[model samples]
Target: MENAKSMEYWLQESALICEFMVFGALAAAIFVAVKFERFWSRGRGKREDYVYDNVLWRPCWRALHPAGLMAYRAIVFLFMAVVLAFDLHNGGIHIYYFYTEWTFTLVIIYFGLATLISAKGCRQLAKNDSIRNQDVRANFLKTDLEQEAHVTESPGKNLDGDSVKLQSHQEREEQKKRAGFWGYAMQIIFQTCAGAVMMTDIVFWFIIVPFLTNEHFRLNPLMGSMHSVNALFLVIDAALNSMSFPWFRGAYFVLWTALYVVFQWILHACGLTWWPYPFLELSTPWAPLWYFGLAIVCLVCYTIFTFLIKAKEKNFPKWFPYAYQRLH
Candidate 1:
């Protein structure tokens, strides 16, 4: 009976593998077909000094009003946190032992960081307000003022009220420049978290959950939706934020997966009895094939998201009358 059950389990796993492989290959083909040249070349193919473009979009992403963006971040942060709490409640804190939970948690941290940074950037301004240009100009002004200070050769130049006010402005500008560290950190975190979120959630929903039905692992409705919810939260965040999804940062996605795989291997070396997903088990002779297949899936996942964001930029103006046209 034990041997018969083992045979049945392997049969079910085989069926799941075939189903996911066929579907994934077809979907990847369709996704790549949207912009064939980009995939062939791994990018838009313009040579540049940086691996990724400095400006995510042409006119700059900061054009989006910070107040709206802040509110969006807060909402996303709250929603994901609540869902995460619910998931933990259902499965116990041991849930974090899984990559899906950890990746989703990383996204929550991304939003938490985003909310705080946006609030700082907004500076009690209204929804339509953004000080991006003002801040940039202030930095330039501060630089000029410092240069002038070094060049001042007069023994004592008597300053008027205007000079005092200008000096005060320069001081504030320097402070503003110092506060910009969070904003830069926010950009890198956002880019890395976006790809990681998509990869984790997509694989769970499309591939892992389906096979787990027959295994000891079982996905309830909420668990099933967790993947989709994670994706939805990040996609909405991207749409509303002033950030662009740069394709070259796909390196981050690769790094994120490598870290997870390494973690699993470590667990296995320490005598863990099983793998989280069937394909991840390195004990089999076909382990390399499974690894290569999953790598292809990861590329496809990133490509699909890249297309989605670019499509939003390309089509938003056509669909929405006023605000969409002003997004960038």
Candidate 2:
């Protein structure tokens, strides 16, 4: 009873730390948004000028364009539902109910708040641009006949007889050149971090846990099945990461899986199991077959996840970042 109490106390403390980390991340995200707004506003001479100034920020407002909002909301809510289901299944309410309820609760709350703020910013920017465009049109309409005749005589003759297209093209080229080295570096870092987290979670769930649990290897059908299911999810997670960021997908998954296997082997040799998964006794040749089958299942799961992500990208381009723009 005392040991159980001690374990409970430790878990409570850990959960508190996790909560702090989540809030810290949210705060940092907000800070980044504010800084970007300030910097862009200063550079563009007006807040509205910075709104449609960059292709990178286009995803935030893509939801407000036609049916995009419905898809965005659906995907986010589905992800939240999955997280909630996992928490409930893992006894989240009972275990951390008293000690860290607010921590887990705040994750969803903060995410929603951030999304709403971004959407509002996009809407305000759009409205401002519309008003500015109207003002420009009115000025053009009031121009004297000679001025209008000169404008129409230009080489670039659109229905509006404005040279706006050439100016827009030139501006795009300038913006591309101005996106310096630091921007590219930060993009790579962010992508790498996301990939690393997904890979770590997979290693922890499948390879580390199963290899460490003795009961998992004893072929107790129920335990074996549960372990299999957990492993399957880890594989799916890896696949999802790869699909979401396709540029380094193959390299990240392959390198991380190799590293995780090597680490597990070293742990096994030392008679130390850092994860909770049960390992099969190596004495039986059939053990290799069973493990191999689990590996195949993982591969299949990855394939399925890749297809799903591709479909999602087609439907909601804003859901994921553009790897090329982000990296360069």
Candidate 3:
């Protein structure tokens, strides 16, 4: 019996390590493909209908350009729904409803918010460049031409064209809408959610599920896929969405985990003796140290994602399908 248990433990460990490698390779391939823009131009012999962006994984994203953001969000929203529903079905509403589950729910909400924004802005996004160019032409060149023909300059006087330039400038300024409160809220929420997704899942696979899950616990496919599924979906959305993730946003990530810790403590106080995660339990003498260590781990996870965004901006052009442009 002891040997059987040992062998089962090793089998689970091996499978988890394999999953880690597979997901790592997929992420690396995506990072490289997007950085080099390898598939942006062509895929072969005069076939314009060929696979463009994400050629290695075709049909994941489409060719509709601006609408791609909406598509990506939609897919993420659906996958998160499945994960959430499956989790709720598995455990109902117990105290063991873990932090990963909450974070996953947060991600679903963020994706829903993103999809709403994308749907609202799609038409304007599609037409922005052409409309701006036309406005420039009308304000600078065509208007100046008309002024030249109709209102001729005096002998030693000249038309400065300042009014036309100012009008064009004002039009451009009007297009620059400030990202008001909700926009900024969504930004922080999304970045924090991304970091939480990675951290919570990593802990689940390596620490909780393997060594800590009860001996008689029977795992379903959805339970097995939870950790990788969270990270994979977020990475896909990261690859296909244009969002600016600043370094300071890591503060929000810290706040999110703090909230989860507080919630767990509350649950413990309210007659729940068991913790969803062993390291999170406050019954030990090392509880404070465990909390501190977990906080540090969360920060590291957040920093890793911040660096991922930095890599995207540094390696690729601003105009790449979906990436933030660095300020000059």
RMSD versus native structure for model 2: 13.3
Q: All candidates' TM-scores? A: 0.63, 0.36, 0.64
Q: TM-score-based ranking, best first?
A: 3, 1, 2
Candidate with best TM-score: 3
RMSD of each: 11.0, 13.3, 14.4
Query: How are the candidates ranked when ordered by lDDT, highest leading?
Result: 1, 3, 2
Counting only residues 3 or more apart in sequence or on different chains, how many pairs clash (N, Cα, C under 3 Å) in candidate 2? 4
Best by lDDT: 1
Candidate 3 weakest lDDT stretch, 10 residues: 49-58
Residue-by-residue lDDT tens digits, candidate 2, 174-198: 3443323433232233233333333
What TM-score would you give candidate 1 relative to the actual structure? 0.63
User: Which candidate, 1 or 2, would have the higher lDDT against the true structure?
Assistant: 1
Model 3 lDDT per residue over 1-328, tens place: 1121233422454333433433444455354433432134232322212222211111222344546767877787987787688778867876145786788788888888777766656655446556655665555665556667868634212223544555566445533443444555566567788789889777777667777777434456776677677777777676655565655456566656766665764565455555677676543456556666666677688887878766766665635555333221
